[model samples]
Target: MSSSFPFPIKPVPFMYLGDNDRNLPDLSDDEFCDLVAVLKALARSSYPRLEAVPLALNAYNCNQGTDDDGERPWAYFYPITMIPPARLDEKNDLLPNYPEIELDFEVCQDLKRRWRSIRYGGDDNNNNQSMEFSPPARYRFLCFIHKHRIDRKNTLQKGVHTISIWDREWDELIWHDTYHVDRISRRKDIREFWRHVKAPGFIDEVDSREHFMSRIRYRTVYHICEQIEETLRGPVPPRHTIYAVMSTALFHMNNARDLQVSIVPDRLELFGGQHKGLLPRFFAHLLCLCLDVRPGWSRARQKRFVLQFRILERLQWMRLRTREYLELHDSDRDGEYRVDAKKKDGGGRQWMYEALNIP
Candidate 1:
């Protein structure tokens, strides 16, 4: 169906989820200000619902604390719209009565060209069935807070002060506080709450920003591990190769040093799927070796592995080493070689190291 709104109804320029360079398209200060103004004005009258389009931005407070310290600002977008999917009949054909079908901005260009070809019978592509049944594209206006820039005074500026549309899919995973959802239900004005931090009703909800960073970092690590798994499917990678892959991936991320020292036991719990928490299959088996635990042990038994050695191996994986681990050194016993067991198992095998408390 056609929109009742007048001419300027078009999707804004957008960025796909997981884009590294998430800055808004370069625009002059005046243009940027005007865009925000128009969006706000439109929300006030033309689209009242847009005023409630809540957005949670992970704000990194660079001046006060480490990169991991951040606040989730209760922000909202003033201008955002979605065009609904086409009405399809029982046979999966567009309804004859509905003539005007608005194409989604995300898939419009490619779909338009392909639809043209199909209508004219100009192409006989075998992939048409897949394309026809593909899920509808749903785009939404989203924003990313720019990394703080150092001002002339050498202090980090409050970045992303104004909203400029950098679009994303509606279902994209965002940094949000679920608490606000309940607050909004109670009719709390979140925008005002964040704005007036010193207000009597204001609550201190700011939390360690590492969780958000961890999400991103974990995705990066998982994908890297996935690629490594796919490439070296059969043979177990040597310790050095395994170490190289893990170290390089961690080194590139924020708080690399700290992360390498230990991946919280809870974080290990996060890794799971068809491999049954033993993602990449081989990596899990090798993890036992790194921590001096038995290989091919079930996940329950694996959970009891020593945290310290795993962290050391994980750290080694994140860094570049010119030399192999020294077999004679005392530290080598911590990772490169197994430590002498203080006791023996019921089966008469030497017991592995005792599980250390997670820091």
Candidate 2:
């Protein structure tokens, strides 16, 4: 648990996984060096693993070909450490008798606090059963809490704790989240691969980079945890909380101005569990599957009613976000999604938008 101040640093490999030998927008040698330095920072910070710790970043249209085209977006990664749950006595600071757990803080503060409180009888309020239990079953308890939490529904808010980088980019900050699980990769498992795009096989050096970016996608952290649970013996977990953000964000971020960006108040919420209520379920339902990429999509409509809860009229976040969205269009849906199904399914739906805490 003890680490030196400033976390005295070490450089890591940043194998550039793209094609740079072809026609790019053109960059002066000086600009290239600065850009490479920025990229180096990205590599150093954002290392990916084939396991739960893999950091998959969307480095697309990142440099705008070269320098001659326009202002280039910069790259950097956020390194994270995941902590294991707190210990049995709760007060006994062994923290599950493991070495320091390293994961995104923002995404999972609940584990220990919930554990500590349950073990110590702190929270007077009642939700799940009182936390009294033995220490040896920490992982089982973890599985229990995760399973029960998701089966319960919109009761728990905030989100899984995460350490993320909010780098400023062209009137907005484009970013990614990393959950470094501190495990090594076998690399051979395509299914184990995270934040990485795999092609049928290798390509010409020039085209390899393009093919790689095209394959970038997201997976639920639970998917990662599920894999972990499977690695253990005895009972496999019933289900893990992938949380809406993971599945929805590819479970990653993309721009709609071409699929992404922001936040605000006036009492608002957005996506997944936003004020949309039934709409959130609607999205959750779609996202829960839609992954098969099979012809069975035609059967999709048969289950349409699965998500058909009546809309909660004028949901708070819906109204607030809608207003903010109009303000961005200077007021308009851009008639984008209306004409094209793919566009509508993707970028067009986010027709209007803005960041709250908007400047």
- lDDT against the true structure, per candidate, is 0.24, 0.25
lDDT of 1 by residue, 1-359 (tens): 01232321112332222212112222334433343332232212121122222110111101011223221111112222221123446774553231222323433432222221212233322235665533322122123211111122322322111112211211122222111112221112222222222311111111233332222211112233334446766322211121222222222122222312223222222221112222122222222223222234554454443332222323232111201111111222233223323323312321222232111
Residue 308, candidate 1: Cα error in Å is 58
List runs of model 2 lying over 4 Å from the truth: 1-13, 17-53, 58-81, 86-359
The deviation in Å at residue 137 for candidate 1 is 22
Give the residue spans of candidate 1 off by over 4 A: 1-26, 35-67, 70-81, 95-359
Judging by lDDT against the true structure, name the best candidate.
2
**lDDT, model 2:** 0.25
> How far off is residue 56 in model 1, in Å?
13
Cα lDDT, model 2, residue 58: 19
RMSD of 1: 25.2
TM-score against native, each model: 0.16, 0.22
